[model samples]
Target: MGTVRDILQTKGHAVYSIHPDITVFEALRVLVDKNVGALIVLDNEKVCGIFSERDYARRVIVKGRASKETLIREIMTENPISVTENDSIEDCMVKMTEKHIRHLPVMDHQDRLVGMISIGDVVKYIINEQKYIINNLEGYIKGTR
Candidate 1:
């Protein structure tokens, strides 16, 4: 039953972003440097969209567009779906599954970008939560709780 807040607190709310006007080559370099698959497309400190490797494969490569010549905005997913820090992990999973998305940008109550979470983060958190629950149950059964 952990919330997105718990995950953010554990993982730290650091977001990597790129400008929509940047070339896809530049964005891809940032992605490699950051070791991440997605980057938030920020304009004036606001979430505008998201750019991912999938964007390159689907929008650029498949379409025979040059990465150096193509702007990230041309390939980025515009107005990507986002979640708040208070949103439940279950809610994020449902949205991601339904939308066929891998990453979700997290916002605060003030509508400010806080962090981003991948489906991997959610699954890892859930696995850890289940492990904790199982350990507690075992402790109880062993009269150790």
Candidate 2:
């Protein structure tokens, strides 16, 4: 019954993003500073796409594209799959698996970008839910609940 809100509440929904027109080098600096694998490519504060360190390696460095010369939009994944805050962790997992992605941005009912979630976050929430269920069952068995 747990949702992304639970994970966000614990892990925080604050996101680090970059503008689409910024050079790949600038985006790289933000990624390194945040120690995150990806950055939300924004256009006027709206989620435009997503760029990851992987994209830079595959599209820029390996392909002879200069990081300082290339733009994030040139390499970013456009219109990334997004979810709502009310969505269950299970729903998020299915979407990521079908899409073969590791990250998903969460939004509100009005489609306002809220936070980002990773596969690791989904796994952690599931583990915590299982533990809670087990603990409650044990307590009930011991007549303590």
Q: Which candidate number has the best lDDT?
A: 1
C-alpha RMSD of each candidate structure in angstroms:
0.8, 1.5
lDDT of 2 by residue, 84-141 (tens): 8888888999999999888999988887899999888899889989999999999999
Cα error, residue 56 of model 1, in Å, equals 1.2
lDDT of each: 0.94, 0.91
User: Worst 10-residue stretch by lDDT in candidate 1?
Assistant: 105-114
Which portions of model 1 miss their true places by more than 4 Å? Answer: none
Off by over 4 Å in 2: none
lDDT for position 145 in model 1: 100
Write the residue-wise lDDT of candidate 1 on 72-119 in tens digits.
988899999999988999999999999999999998888789999999
How many steric clashes does model 1 contain?
Answer: 0
